[model samples]
Each structure stands twice: as structure tokens, then as C-alpha cells.
Target: MHRSSDTIGAIAAALAKAQGELLNPEKNVIATIRSPFPREESRTFRYASLASGLEIVRKSLGEHEIATVQTTAIDHATGQIQLTTLLAHASGEWISSDWPVCPITETANPHRMGAALTYARRYALFALVGIAGDDDLDAPDLLVEPSPTVQPPEDPHQNRPIPRKSNGSIHKPRQPKPVLSAEPSAVLRDQLVAEIKELNGADDLALWAHRRLPTKNTLTAEDARMVETAYQAAVGPLPGRLDDQVTPLLKTAQKRNKAHLRFVAEQPCLVCQRTPCDAHHVKFAEPRALGRKVSDEFTVPLCRDHHRQLHHHGNEIAWWGNVQIAPLEAAEKLWQETLAAPRPTFRSGVQHHPRPKADERGASSRDSG
Candidate 1:
């Protein structure tokens, strides 16, 4: 949150009074957008449009000598759109908050993106003004009574007994036979050998040849091309690996920005909604070295159990893949927020930061791979 230093006290007092008297915008739009899931049901969603929300906020805050402005900008580094909501008082004091606006659909459809931006702006404005609509895009659909006419598809062979042959043996379906390819030509064999030789030394190539091609009688053209492609991929030019070496002194001097860590710890866990999380260092974000963690900027908010589970998962990159969480992108986004407006470090004697609630703690995720 940003505010004018000279008129902070005045703005605070005015904001508190305005919040007490602010009015919520009416739900003016009822939409029936289809669900992304194929099998799940969809429901009609009611929300206030951006224009309606702005009307309410302007009319309400204007009465209290306050004005508001909302704007959007692109973050060049991540190519993500950010919406900022600013509230200004007549006393020359102001405060604002920035939120990342994300599109639901993957395609670059202008209409869908505009809808996402509108949703974000409406909610951000309402949230800043201390009011909200009946529902929001971020919330899950509320449970409702199921329609009596709608029923699940019935199984055609429910409770049927297994088929048996006349010999009293259970019948089994035949499996498809594997198709074998024709033998590779001598020219293809020579090309494969050359490709392997270029990728590996003679000894390594001989070892691979012995294991994969026991005899030329078994090798096919497909097999030769497959071997050639495998060698190329194994030693080919690729994205930079995080396991590359780094200087010891440079790794040691990596900044442990307490302010960034503290800010990240305040956010809800990426897996669950539990707050007051641990700033988990995503080790794959930077080079791995003996007894060294990645810089603090590469951290994600995770609970104690998830943090511990991540460390013991054996493969950090694969573990993140299973849960569909992009730690590097998330960390970079949060770090960008800090860079836009720096947060102060924690004061002395406040070393023990707030912890998650008792109920929120120790709730291990069953599918946290």
C-alpha cells in the first residue's frame, strides 16, 4: 500500500470514516459462462460490472471529499498485466494497491483478456473501498440443489458376471502383437555410428553400441534414427541447467533480504490457503552448490509440512511439476512487487514472526508430491 507521507494521518482518519459509511455496488450483471471442465456443471454468476462498481464508489467516496483512480500496466519482465487501484483524499493524501490480472483462457483472445481485466478492476476497486459484490471470479461456485430431472448416465453392464468359455475357463481379450520394422540399411547404420561418435568418445560409443545393438541382425532403420536422435538430444544445446557450477564467494554473498522473506511469509501458501507461511527457497531457481540455498528472491510461500516435504521429495523440479505450481514465476512476481515499492525490514525485538493458526498448522496435503 502506498500513501503520501505528509498527509498519512489525515488520510487514515478519512479512510476509516469512509469505510464505515461506504455502500456496496449492486450486482447488475448475470452471466452464464460455460465451465472449462467438460463433465462438471455450470451455474449463473451474478456480479457488478466495472462501470457499475465505479459508479457506486465514485458517488459514495465523492460525498466524503475523496476520489479514486484505477489503471493497468504491463510488467515487461514477466509479460503479465497488473491493475492498480488508488484512493485519494482532498487533503492531498493517497493510498493504492497493485494486483496481477490473469487470463483464464490460454489463448490470446482479446475478448477473454478484456473480460479478465474488467473482473480484476471491479474487484480491486471494491476491495479498496471496503465493499464487495455477492460473488467474485476468484470464489468457487456455491453449492445449490441439484435438478431432479438430471441423472448420471447408467452403466450398461452393471453387476454382470464374467464371461466363461465352454471349457470352464475365464475368457480373456487378445492383446495386439508388436509390429517389427525391417532391418536398417548399411548407409543408415553408418550415419548412426557417425552421429554417436560425434556425441561421445570411442569407448562410450562402443559401450552404447554393445548394449543397444547386440548384433546388426536386430537393428532397423527406425532404431538407427532413434539412436541418432537420442545422442543428439543427450548432448545437444538446451536451456541453461540450474545445476551448473558457480563461484563459492558469489554464492555465499547471496542476499537474504529479510523484507522480501517477511513479505512472502505473509502470503497464503501456494498449495493450500494457509497464511503465515515459510519463505521456501526454490533450489532449482539458481545453481546448486554444496551447503548453499538459492537466493532469497527465489522463494515461495509454503507451510512447514509442505516445505519439509519439498526438501525430501528427492526431485525438486519434478515435485513442483506434480502439483502444477511454477515456483520460479511466482517468486519472480512477488520479488517484482517488492522492487516496485520496497518494504521496510522488520524492527528489532520482532524476530518471531506470526505463525499460522493452530487449525491451519500440520495439515499435511495428501497429494503434495
Candidate 2:
């Protein structure tokens, strides 16, 4: 019965191909036979035999060969045998039996079949994009293959194995030790303290003014002592006053004037009243004059956003001109207004200038009494 079915299948496959209905039917049968079998212990041997035969045929013939097969199974209740033949195409499509079947085509490149199968196993039916033909295989595709085991590069600076010496040997370079700047010794500290105490008692403002003035880069120990004493007198007993804060402030003010002294002259941001505000010069100082340490009256402290806004609305703020206005009065007024006046609801983040409220108008009328 099996031999008769095979012959009938071959004849049917040939007829289908002659009729231009089947194309490369052999691969289609191989694909069907290679498909996973259903769980039936009785059919295990049959399934294995079919798989082996399909594999052998696939090895002997190229993947493009066409074939077909027919099977007749007896319907026990009807007591009739039904015969059907299927033409299998290389593209894995099967035609005939009871209904018409669509012919499948080779959509993927044959060379990338292994890679495609690997990717399908890993990613589960993930479709590859832009893979057309042989031309699509480039350097990127070659790199996708498994690479050989690569050894790490050797370090050139590694010490070579040498014979041991009788005594421990040292190989120090004959370079002279570099001389660092002379730091104030313990003796200098004691002298500095005494001078600071004396300067504190004498004239504090003079000491402060002296510290603000710049000294030459070639200042001696005596000059450092004098500067330290003056700085201590100005700042008093504030924590980290001498070294951390005072010295840096004085140095900055001296080197680039009070404008460059970030903390000394800077106020809280005008908009947010936040500390560490940006230094914004109302007048654009010439780049050349920046290093001269000239005291300019046109600088102000503004946060980043407000500084940008100041430049954007330069014409409005320009009314103040290059005149240096002290922030103490403005800050005092703002504080007073916040306390005594009705709190004005800000529509946005900006604070509008103070205006007379209704209560203030009433109070003024009553004060006339």
C-alpha cells in the first residue's frame, strides 16, 4: 500500500508541476515530515523512520526538488477508502487534497537561513527588516557569526623575571626633590597671632582697608604676617574667618576688585532671594579692563533667570543706568512692605512693586484726625 501511494504521489506531483500548479514540491514534503510529531507512543517508530528518510532524501537532492504523495485510509464506519494527493512546493506550501492552497515564495535570503533559524529560536517569530538578497549581506552580518577565542593583550610595563641579589637593592632615580612654596611655620603662627591681637586693638577699619589692598606676588613672610593680622582684625573671631573666607575674599577683591569678589559684594537674587546669586554687571565692561582690578559701580547680583531677563528687557532696567545703587535700602523697603502692607497675590513668580492698599488709604484719612 505504501509503495503504491508513493508512486501515485510522484505521478500526481509531476502532473501538478506540468500544469504549472506546483513548484519545488519536494522541499514542502520534507518540511512537513520534519515538523514536530503529535504525542502518540504507538507512532514513535513510524515518526522516526519518516524523519530519517526525509533527512536522507534532503541530503541526496538539493533543496529545490519537487515531490508529491497520496494516502488512502479506510473509514471504518462508512466502510469506504478515501484517496488524496498533496503537491508540496520548495517554499513550504502544500496544494491539493480537498481545497485550493496559496503558493508560498522565498521571502528570505537562503544564505541567512541558519542565522534566521537561530534568531527565530531566540526571539520567537521576530521578523528581520531590509533583508532582500545576496547584496544585503555586509560586514554587519559577518560579525553576527560566532567569533574565535581572543587572548588579552600583554602589558609592556610588567616587571621581567631576574636573578635575586644577595642584599635588597634599591633603584631610585637621581632626580632632585622639588621645592614647594614656603608654608608658614609654627613660629610664624605664634607671631601672626600676636600681630593680629595688636592690630585688633589699634584700628580695625585701617586693618580691613589694608587687607583689601593687593600685595605683590613676591611678598615675603613679613608681608604674609601683616596680611594675616589685618584679615583677622577685619573678620574678628568668626569660624573659618582667616583662612577659609577672609583670605580668599581679600585676594579676589584685590586681584579683580569688589565686583569679582562673589560673596563680599553679592546680595541674594533679586527675584528669588536665594544665596549664591550670579554676578550681573548692569553695564557691559570692556574685556580688556576686566583684569585691571578697577572698581565698577554698575554690577548687581541676580539669579540666572533674572539675569537673563535683565538682559532681555535691557531698556527697562537701563533707567538705573551705570549708577551703583546700594541694595540695603531696597531690601529694607521690601521687608517693611511685606510686614505692614496687605500681601499682594503674585499672578506669576515675579514680585510687583508696592502700591498703596485700601486699608492704607483709610488709615491716612483717619490719621488726619
Candidate 3:
């Protein structure tokens, strides 16, 4: 606090008188901030305009023989902007306070510096006097919000204020705002324009264009190209088209074994549990020569009814898909198990083969001593 050589008794008394008649400044200014970080939800901030706040306090102070002057200067020692508010009484007694000005931008931004100076003057005046606007007292520092119509400098390296805490205090430096280029790609622009012109007067062109364009106004070349790119991606051929091609047959050296087919036939139908089945080959499981049956190792047991149903379906893949069963997987499992089983051993001139009970179509092997 700075004061005149005389004690501040007269000014302090005048300030006390003015405080009783002072009205809380009206919050007349509205600011809408669209932040890009942490998702793009817009927030609305309401604060008193500097002019409105000054009018209210000055009117009250004048009635009580108190005059106030606000001035700005550079603190040479610290190289900081300082706002000094002086309240002088008619008796030569005065009191003043110096407040550090917070710059909106780090660089020497004339426009932002002007805004910062105005912001500092209002807060400092309110503090010197004993009054505040609604919610203004709660804010630890002034918040400099730009008007919507004003475009900021196109500096890519510009810094933005840090987001306020829940209590509205700024404890850290600001972050850099994301910059979007204004100009659109020239090649992309022409291509999009040509395509759009061809669709003129189409029945749904208006609606389609409205939905595609970012806004109703004439779209920039860049925006039009973005829409075209998005549309092509939406209607373009999907990835992994190779999966639709037929899988080539995987050749193996193993010869067909009738005994494996016989074992498969002994099992129940893959679709139904009725016994006395036929070893049905899943032709689609592997590619084969025309009119040649697949190896017995690929045969799965099916009852006479299901076997006929499968042939009627014609598309083996489609039939398996409808039945919600994988005969190819079952066939491979059964063949491997059968091949791994020990050959029948003869004891006392009698043939011995181990037989395990079948759980429906799934086949298992066992050995009997």
C-alpha cells in the first residue's frame, strides 16, 4: 500500500462512508468459450464489464469527497506490469495499492495487453474500494475472455490459459490452443467441386449436401474435400476381400483308409443321435479334382436322413452353417484319434480291439487288456 505523507485517516473515513452506499457491479458481459481440449464442450462465463463496475464505484466514491485514479507502469526490477490505484480525499490524505497485471498472452501482444490492462484496472479498482460484483469476489484473478467475432492471431505457437480449478483459481500457466488451417487443398477442392456440380438438381441432393457440409454457408474447398473423402470411405470396398476367395486344397501324402471310414460309420449322426450311420465326406472341407471323393480322413458320420439332407442342401458350407455344426473340425479330430490308436493285438488266437462308448458324434479310443 502507498499513501501520502499525511496519515490516511481522512481517505479511510471517506472510503468507509462510500462503502455503505456502493452497489455490487452488474454482470453485464457474457462470454462463451469453446475449449478444444478434454473434449469440446462450450462453457459460458458471465462477468461485470470494466465500464459498468467503474461507474458504480466512482459514483459512490464521488458523493463522499473521495476521488480515484488508476494508472499502469512497468516494475523495472521484476519486469512485470503493475496497476496502481490511488484513492485521494480532499484533505490531501490518500491510500494506494499496486497489483501485478496478468498478461493474456506470453508474447508482446498489443491487443491482448490492452485487454489485460482493462481487466487489471477493474479488479484493482474493486479491491481498493470495499465492493465486488456477484461471484467476482470468488475469482482469485481476472479472466480475459475474447469476444466471439474477434479472431485471434494466427500464431501456431500462441499460449492459452490453463483451465481453472473447481474453485476458479488459475494456479498454472496456460496451454497452447490447437490451430486449424484456414485454406483448403487446391487439388482436393477442384475434384469435390466437379463431383458436386454433376449432382445438381438430384432429388436428394439438397438433403445430402446439407448433411455432408459442415454448415449452410458456402463450404471452403478443404471442407468440401473432407466430405468427399468421408463419402468415398463410407461407400468404398472393405478391407480383407481376399478372405472371400476359395482356399486352395492342402495336399497330404497319407492314403485313404477304409478302416477309418468304418470306424466313423460306427458313430452316431453328427446332427442326430440315431446309430447305423454312413461316413459322409465334407467335400467343401478341401478342394478336390472333379468327380473325385475326398479322403476318408475327412469323412464324418451322419445318419441316412441327415446325409440325404446335406446332399440336398448342395452347398456343404451353407449346410454346416445352417446346422451350426462344424463337421470338418469333427472329422479331423476323429481321424487323428483313430490313426493314433494302437493296432488290434491277437491273444490266444482271438482278435482284440478296444472300443469306447461314443458320446453322440464325438469319437474316442481306448485299449482293452
| RMSD per model, one decimal | 19.6, 32.4, 31.3
User: Candidate 1 on 75-136: residue-level lDDT in tens?
Assistant: 64333577888888888888888877752222357877787787788778777778887565
Query: Can you give the TM-score per candidate against the true fold?
Result: 0.37, 0.17, 0.35
lDDT per residue for candidate 3 within 179-259, as digits (tens), equals 334543444455555554554232234334544344312345456556566443442332321122222234444348988
- The TM-score obtained by model 2 is 0.17
Runs of candidate 1 with Cα error greater than 4 angstroms are: 1-7, 102-109, 136-369
Task: Rank all candidate structures by their TM-score, best first, as comma-separated numbers.
Answer: 1, 3, 2
Error of 1 at 108 (Å): 6.9
Candidate 1: the clashing residue pairs are none
lDDT of 3 at 306: 72
Ten-residue segment with the worst summed lDDT in candidate 2?
A: 124-133
